[model samples]
Target: MKLLTHNMLTSKCLKGVNVGYPLGIVAKDVKVLETEFNSEFVSRIIPKLDWDTLWNAADSIGHAGDLPRAVCDDYENDVEFLKKVHHVLVEVEVIEGELVCPESGRKFSINKGIPNMLLNEDEL
Candidate 1:
């Protein structure tokens, strides 16, 4: 899944898991493919992204250095920043592995670029 998708995901297995968001990426396989840049999209996405979470996810996949500390501040107007955001949000794809929730330790596995978030009946 793209970091854009990851940005919106949070663990829902339990109600009280404070750190449910920002699921830790444990990718056994990953790919980065280039896409056409669109600054408008990046600028619009800045407010929705979690900087720390995106940074950590990018770091896990070896794409961390390009991102700034804040996506909405100094870098918002910078072309380079928008490029980095495009790369992080569009280029990277997780082919396989588990996204472990920081709080509950629930594992959401990704296969063929699709994340399986379905829970057992007990979990619901």
Candidate 2:
């Protein structure tokens, strides 16, 4: 899964989980499959994301590189910053990993860049 998707995923569906957001990542395999960068798209997406969560997620996986810790005052026209955001948002893929819920400690596995978020019968 991309870090962009990880930023929004939550484990709140599980029983007793209040705010199961910002799931913890245990990445066993990480791949940087570079892709075309679109500054406009990145510009639009930055507003929807939680900056801290994105940075933390990337940092956890050791792919943070030189990504800025905070978004600058002027971002849209900043090509370099946008490029870094685009790289982390789309290029980085978790080929094999597990997402752990912050509240219930439930683990969801990711194989081939797909996260299995389905819960067992009793978990729901």
Candidate 3:
């Protein structure tokens, strides 16, 4: 999964969980897939992105120093920033791992880049 998606995901569904955001990345297998950069897509998605959460997830996956706070500030006319965002959001795909929620300790496993967010009956 992209770090962008990971950033938005949280354990808010978990009962009484606190600070469940920025799910801990456990990339048992990771792959960097090349994808065409689309400025419009990046610009559109920027508004929905959480800066802090995206930064934390990128840092966890060893893609730090690319994204800057100002990227969001001047997202309208920043090609470099958009490229970086595109890379973090589209290129880096986590092939396998489990994203654990910090607050509830819920484990969401990812296989072939698909996260299994289904919880057991009790967790539900």
Best model per TM-score? 2
Best by lDDT: 2
Candidate number that wins on TM-score, 1 or 2? 2
Query: Each model's number of backbone clashes?
Result: 0, 0, 0
Q: What value does the lDDT take at residue 16 in candidate 3?
A: 76
* Model 2 stretches astray by more than 4 angstroms: none
User: What is residue 24's positional error in candidate 2, in angstroms?
Assistant: 0.3
Question: Which 10 consecutive positions of candidate 1 have the poorest summed lDDT?
Answer: 68-77
Per-candidate Cα lDDT values, in order, are 0.83, 0.95, 0.81
Better model by TM-score, 2 or 3?
A: 2
Worst 10 residues of 3 by lDDT: 64-73
Residue-by-residue lDDT tens digits, candidate 1, 21-109? 87888998888889999998888888777878888889888887657766555665798879988999889999898888888888999
Candidate 3 local lDDT, 41-93, one digit each (tens): 98998888887777777778787656785455677698988898888887888
**Rank order (by TM-score, best first):** 2, 1, 3
Backbone clash pairs for candidate 2 read none
- Over the stretch 1-124, how does candidate 2's per-residue lDDT look in tens digits? 9999999999999999999999999999999998999999999999999999999999999989999999998999999999999999999999999999998889999999999999999988
Clashing pairs in 1: none
Ranking by lDDT: 2, 1, 3
Model 1, runs deviating above 4 Å:
15-19, 72-76
